[model samples]
Each structure stands twice: as structure tokens, then as C-alpha cells.
Target: MDEAESAARRLAWGVHNAVGFVFTLFWTAGWISLALLVLLATRRRDVALRMAARCWAPGLTGGAGARLVVEGADAVDWSRPYLLVSNHQSVIDICALFQAVPVPLHFLLKQEMAKVPFVGWYARACGMLFIERDNPRAGPRLRREAAALLGAGHTLCLFPEGTRSRTGVVAPFKGGGFQSAIDAGVDVLPVAIDGAGDVLPPEGFRVRAGVITVRFGAPLATGDASGAAGRQALADAAHASVLALLRRSA
Candidate 1:
């Protein structure tokens, strides 16, 4: 491309990012406010999840000009609860999953997130499970809490990588979430999210308009698998499934 064309494209990219950032702020503040009201009025987490699915997810994703496409959504049985595991790439991954997945999913977030200004309040109000990683007793407590939530027929979405990948590759899966699934006796649903890294790079605030694909893989049953060996097997299987989906999406 010529210099003029290249410069024009760069200018357009900057403008789009600027506008998207502003929209994201407003979207977050508005939904958080609504979430607070819902918590005060009804105090039901299901209602908050429905509101997020119908209003926040769609608006936030669409306003950022990010198109969300879900593959293998039919593989999910809405009637049954699942432990949804996915690869972590960027913050946009959360938005993409929330927009594409046709379910009221709850996240297993870090306890530190519970201290964030608006996000923490919203997460707490929605009854998301938070893990205090620094606390010595947090591991067992988290597993028990997660099991209880799953047993209560709530679907939990966890990033088995534990943190976002800076290299845009699927990292090794953690054993905690898989162990929770085993303890809860639920199906582990592997999900692969592609293209979110390009939309918003790690630790960067600028937004880029693009498409993100969320692919749900076949569920791996943790039947009678409560031991460490079983958890490792489940983790490996989930990691492989997510890697395959990422390759296919690419």
C-alpha cells in the first residue's frame, strides 16, 4: 500500500480505538449500576445473570464492534450444569464468552478482583465465587464452595490457565478447576476462544474492533473421578480440546 493509504488506515484504527474505549466506560458503568439495583431489589443471582446475558454482554460486545461467533453451542445441554473451562487470552475473552454462550454463566474470579472499583462490586453482587489465593486455607474452601455452587445447578466458567496468556497460546491447564468438577460430579465443558488477543492485548486498555470466536467442545465426564490422578487426566483432556479448537478456529 502507498504511504497515504497506510497513514489513512492507521488514523482510522486510532479513531476506532478511541471511540470504543469511551463506549466501554459508559457500558461498564451503566451495567454496574443496574446490577447494583437488581441486587437490592430482587437479591437473585439468576436474574442478574439474565440481565448480563441480554443487556450487558450484547451491548458491550456490539459497541466495541466485535462480532461474536459461537461454534458447537448445541453440544451444551442447557438443562444440566457444567464446569466450563476455557483458554485465557485477553479481557475481551470474558466479553466474547458472555456474548456468545447462551447461558447464565458465573465466573471463578480471583479475590483481588473483588476489590476493584466497579467490577468488584458487580462481581460480588452477581454472587461470583472469589478465591483468595494468598490465604492458606483458600484452596480447600474454594473447592468446597465451587462444588456447592455446581450442586446447586449453577454453571461455573473457569480459566484453567489461571491467568491470561501473553503469547496468545493456550497455556497448561490448572488442576484446581478440574478437581472442583470431579468433586462436584459434573461434566467439564472445554471452550476455546480465538481472536480476543488481537482485539485487546494483555495489560493494554486500548480497544480494537474485530471478531472473536468462542468454540465449545464436547464435555468430558468426571464420573467417579475424585482422586488426583483423575483430576490430572481431566485437565489434560480439557487442555487438548481447547488447543484443537484454537487450531481449527485459526
Candidate 2:
């Protein structure tokens, strides 16, 4: 293409993204408010989760002109609770997961997220767990709470990398989620998400249209495993599964 045409296309893309970003803000706020009211009135987490998984998440992605392509979602037994460990690449990964995963999933977030404005309020109301990573007492507390949540039949999603990968590469996994799975006697499920980085890169506010793929792997059992050694083993296995899925998706 000529220089003039190329420049025009770039400007158009930027304008499109800016408009989408504004629309996303309003869309998210409206849905979160509706979900919050449902939670308050019914005190049923399933109601809120259904609204998010079936409505808000998909709405945000669709409004941004993004499509969700999921594979192996049937591999997940929605009837049972499992700890979902996934590789994180972008903020939009959360939306993709919620849209693709059939089960009601709660996130394991940093305790500080509980203080954010709309997000914090909605997260707390949805029964999401937050942990103070730096506080020494937080470890045992998190495990205890996680076990209880699992026992209560909620599927908790954890990004074992702890943060988004700027390079779109899967980072090293942390053992905390695996430990919690072992404590709760629940299986650990590995999910791989791709293409979200192209939609919204780390620290970028604008959302570019793209397709995001979410692939689920077989569940890794943390059977009869306990303590540091068991946690490390489970983490390694789950990481390997996720990395393999990433390769396949590529």
C-alpha cells in the first residue's frame, strides 16, 4: 500500500480502538451493577457468576470486536470443582476464560484488588478470594479459605504466573495454587489462552479486534499429595500441561 493509505489505515485503527475502549467502560459498569444487585437480592453466587460468564464477559469481548474460540471445554467436568491454573498474557485473558469456561469460576486475586472501586465490590460480592501475598499469615489463611471454597463446590481460577507476560510467553508457575488444590483435595486443571495479547497488550487501555483462543487440558490429580514437595510436583505438572497446550495452539 502507498504511504498515504498506510497512514490512513493506522489512524482508523487507533480511532476504532479508542471508541471501543469507551464503550467497554460503560458496558462493564452496567453489567457489574446488574450482577451486584442480583447478588445482593438473592445472595446466590451462581446467579452472579452466570450473569458474568454468560453475559458480561462475552459482551465486553464482542463489543471490542473480538471472537472467542474455545477447545476442550468439554474436558472439564462441570459437575465437579477444580482449581484452574492458566498462563496469563493480557488483562483480557480473564474475560476470555469466563466466556469460554462452562463452569462458574472465581478468581484468586491479590488482596489489594478488594479495595478497587467497582471491580473490588463486584469481586467480593461474587465470593472471590483475595490473599495478601506479602503477609506471612496469608499463606495458611489462603489455603484454609481455598479448601473451604472448593469444598463448597466452587471452581477457583488461578493464574500461577501471578502476572501478565509481556512477551506472550508462559512464565514460571508458582506453587501456591497447587498447594491449595492439594489441601482441598481437588484436581488441578490447566488452561492455555492465546491471542488476548494482540487484543489488549499489557498496560494498554485500547482494545484491538482479534480472536482469543482458550484451550483446556486434562486434569492433573494432586492425589494424596501434601507439603512443599507435593506442591512443587503438582505445579511442575500443571505448568507442563499448560505449556504443551500453548505450543499446540501456536
TM-score for each candidate, following the candidate numbering = 0.91, 0.94
lDDT of 1 at 202: 84
**Candidate 2 Cα outliers beyond 4 Å, as residue runs:** 1-10
lDDT value for model 1 = 0.85
lDDT by residue (tens digit), candidate 2, 1-250: 9999999998988898788788877888888999999988999888898898899898888887789999998767889999999999888888998988787889998888899777899999888999888897778888888889987888999999988998988888988767778877889999999889988889777677898999999998888677787788888888999999989955
- Candidate 1 lDDT tens digits, 1-250: 9999999999988888787888887888898888789878997778777777888878877776678888999867878999999999898787777766676789999888899888898887777899877786888988998998898888999998989999997789978777778888899999999888877888766677798899989999999576787788789999999999989955
Candidate 1 ranges beyond 4 A from true positions: 1-15
Question: CA RMSD for every model?
Answer: 2.1, 1.6
Output the number of the TM-score-best candidate. 2
Whole-model Cα lDDT per candidate?
0.85, 0.87
